[model samples]
Target: MSKTAEEVKRIEEPYVCSKKERLGHALGVLGHDGANTMRGYTMPFLTDILQLPAPFLMILTTLGQVLDAFTDISMGVIADRTRSKWGRFRPWVLRAGPLFCIFMALSFLKLPIGVVGMCAFAGFMYIATGSFAFTAVDIPFWSLPAAMTSNTKERSEIIGGTTTCSSMIIGLTGIVVPLALSAFGKFEWTSYFFTAAIIAVFAICMYLTSFKLVREHVVPDDSVKFSLKLGLKSIFTNQPLLCVQIANVFFLLSIILRSYLNYYYCTYNLGNLSLAAVLSTINTIGMVSGALLFTIFSKRIGKRNCLFISALVCLTSNLVLYFSGWSNVILLFTCAAITTVAIGFGYVCVNAMIADTIEYGEWKTGQRNEAMITSTRCFVTKCVGALASVLVLSSISLTGFVPQATEQTLGALNGFHIMYSLLPAITMVLAATPMFFYKLTEKRHAEIMVELAARKEKKENK
Candidate 1:
């Protein structure tokens, strides 16, 4: 047999993980996603329901997210150093879930304070929910996949399964929130508060349940004491993690920019706001499908190839959509669906790739910084999302868009097209660029795991 065939055979060895445990770990994000959905409502709630100034909302959100991104790194360091009986990362989901959800609930309250005071209150809630509370859970929760199992295929399954579950949560919220909003009527502050509270409750329950079910099977060696400098070095020196981070930022940028413009595209360019719902439904379906298919795709083409191909597909679809124009509504929806599926598939690929880097870092640095490496996922996401929102919002303001107007100006329409099609294409090109530099293949990762396992066993016998 060829050496390549032998390596593939060796790495396919099974790792033990029960369905219940996998379910438990996967369930960890229910509350986070639930609360996040409610948080997504904050902008419309503040601007439309509470009638807050756009400038105030802008400054508060942008600042809060930037703060949140920075906090993620620190939280990662803290999680890595944690040595409780409940395990380094699992206990955090239980500890931080309620408080995080509480802040989420509070963010929606219609305070009786004056405009400036209300803005201050909202800012506090925003920062507390995301920067402090969410950061505590996010690093630990994501770090679990690396800790759960060392098997390459199993790790892919775990990450892919979790993403599939998240997409389902998104789909569920997408359906339920609109119905709740319709029943409560438009601009009803009470509706926003009530919905947020319910989501918080649900999130808290899921977090608790996940805490009970998830187990951290892969514990770090106690002999390797925590060093802040070393943890920082581990992150800085890991080329695979850096490449994945840059790629994800641009990938997420394209998705967010297109999403922000969807409403404008439906309302003005397509002359039907209801079609936004159709496109959204397609996007969600695409996400779930891509996530479900990731394990299979990653096995065949490998994770790096999956990332590269997904980005290329997204870029091509967007370019076609841009040049083809929106003459056919059906064609536009098709492109949107295709792009989201690619986005979904690429997201899972990056996460699994990130997990692989944990072992790579350990192999290279002689220190395993799982949470520290995993923290980049949260860091890049928050920072990129916040920055993207600022860019899109600023672009919208410049377009002379008038809310509630029957028609938008030609410039506004053109701007929507650029955001929806052209901008995403550009970002996808950037997203794919980093993939060229991502050199961590599955065979390499498998070899690293073997060497690390041997090192661990030798240390134990001594």
Candidate 2:
């Protein structure tokens, strides 16, 4: 082979991440999903206990995303500027643990205060955790693997491990939260917080542990300082980053909407709330299984190819549910399981692709803006999650949904069908389209690294 090809092959060996490190990295996602079980109870409790209108509840969600989106951008810019012995992201994760624990727990604990309407309660909690508290932790936490290693295979493995672990947590939460709340009953507000508090304790401990085990390998050049304006501008210029962001934001919305819709689907349509556990448990299991399989495929093939397979899975699964009219219980659970598996695959691919974009940005622009890159990722996720809330809740409102009613009208049932099956299928397919344009294959990334290293060496000699 050519001398250039030989040199590129030689440089690739050091970047592959080890198994122990991948496991450590996976532990970090628990910080987000630890309390995820309790999170499943939020909407149900809002309705039965507080009797809040669906529209107003969505207003709180949308407002939080709008208000907190600024924090994502600002945090990204600030993290880029951070200097410490522990590295840029490590300090942020370790420092933010206590605040995340406190605010997240308080958001669940401080509910239904006297004279404060359910509207006020919902507003307070959603903004407190989603916008202000956890946003700090999320941006830095997800940014680590990118900083840890540049190898595509290892990065996919790390992200897949995280996704699988999160699915396991969500699955457990799905089963436990409903059973706990049923035991606590509708009026038992105090009991709900007890569950959340438990989740917080475990969540915080795991987060801190993950931070300690993590070691940042990508050290940026400290001599340069970048304004938030420039950092944001740099992101727009990176095509692959935008492609992944667009696709992922919509993909996030599709799954969250389905998740939010599950309660209504099980309660109103099927007339049994307990079935949510069964469905969620099945879906989460499928997700964990799918992620493990894709992690293997990602190493053999490529990230974009794996992503296409996932998108196809979502599209097909969604279509089956839509055609079934969201009515058949057997089909509903079966399709949800299949679709969730695809979502699991997408989760790993998107994360690995995001890390790859960091390298792309540094190569094209000569700036290692890891925080800026990751922070926008968090912003898109939060913002889309907020928008999904607005859209899904607004559809319910338009259908004339009656909170806490014994039975919803046919119109509302149809709304559930649309939200749960139809829209997700459409968006799932739409999310796949932009992904086709992502061009940074594994081979290209290796060459970019070789080029980046040479550039650094040449500058140092001068």
Candidate 3:
């Protein structure tokens, strides 16, 4: 017999769990995507492998990411309105997972026929198309956690674990990629493609493993209508969600800047491309360790407080890095390590807070739209990323970065330092300011959940 809406709503027992197992499952999904074959590999390829000019490369990458912002949100709406035998988000993840992997692998292929401009165009299109497929899987994958469990502590642990594992995988890639390139005695585009292929395979395996370990709660039919107008309205009307979204925009922008500059810093200033990978690995380790610690602390101090604290730590670390003398690699590493930890700590709380906001929406409007909420998060993230790419590339132009210069002048080196250090530090401080107003406490969340449960029961009885 086909299950009625009431029966589906009644089957809530599947959401229960110990924090550890839930964390593991969440980590699996995050690691699969976060090492992010599309993201971690693509931009570098465009800059280094294709040898596209910085300005043009930035424009293409930014446009593609901006397009993804819209695509991700739209996919979220579709997922929210969807009904499938495998529940709301999981079926989409399962269906899109392999295709995403395939496209990621294909995106690395360089064409022989195209001259510089044509090759650049082809590469940009390939990445943009692959990113679209990625959004199809990513939107719902993130949204699933909101529907997974209502316990705030468990949610924090889950998010924390996921972020930690993802960072670790990313860190491992930093070390592995350079070593692989050196080992193969290759510096041409083929090395880049081969490395991407290896990562793609790993990502696919991890995603399938995650799919097997994780399960989704059935979404109620009472969720919001999946319309563009409605999605925008909901986001604007939800104050707490909006604040978090804004903060995430700044946070992600800072991350993009850091990523774009890290390569420049290593290659030009530090005089070692390999050091970029080592620094990235160290940064990832700091992130993993911080996430684990944050999960422990969140149990005692709560998510909101933890977020505030992490933000403070991040702000302080950035400031320290920005002002310290250029010769101090140890000081820079210390600050970077601190900031990485802050990001790890803050990310878990941010995600849990988003899940909490979903409950708040359900309580107020009697609508559960996990996909839309997740998409809202993605929208802000992508916009920030797009903006950061523009800023990085534009700054490169403004600072007179001569990419082909045999010897980098002192002025060019200084410009790179300022972009890498001072700019991101300033932005991160701004990002931390809005969190003071976020008001979702554990008591408040429990109250909201109770009211939502009552509303569900009333609708079922009717």
Please, what is the whole-model Cα lDDT of each candidate in the order they appear?
0.79, 0.76, 0.69
| Candidate 1 local lDDT, 232-332, one digit each (tens) | 88888989889988988998888777755554577578986557667768878998888877777787889888888888899899998998787789899
Q: Across residues 161-192, which tens digit of lDDT does each residue of candidate 2 receive?
A: 77788888887777776667667764567767
Q: Which candidate comes out best when scored by lDDT?
A: 1
On a 0 to 100 scale, what is the lDDT of residue 344 in model 1? Answer: 85
| Candidate 3: count of backbone clashes, pairs at least 3 residues apart or interchain | 0
lDDT of 3: 0.69
Candidate 2 worst ten-residue window by lDDT? 109-118
Worst ten-residue run, lDDT, model 1? 1-10
Q: What stretches of model 3 exceed 4 Å from their correct place?
A: 1-24, 34-38, 116-127, 182-187, 222-231, 404-406
Which has the higher lDDT value, candidate number 1 or candidate number 3? 1
Please write out the lDDT profile of model 3 over residues 1-462, one tens digit for every residue: 243334434543344655544654665565455436235555556655665677676667667776776687778878887776667877776777766776776666777755675566555555554457677887877877666665544555566666666677766776677666556633466876777777777777766766666766445664445455655565667778878777777777776677767766776787667776778777788878878877688768987778778777877787777678467888878888888888877776777778778876655455666788888877676666667667766766676666635468787777777767777777777777777787767666665555666676797799
Higher-scoring candidate on lDDT, 1 or 2:
1
Q: Quick one: ranking by lDDT, best first?
A: 1, 2, 3
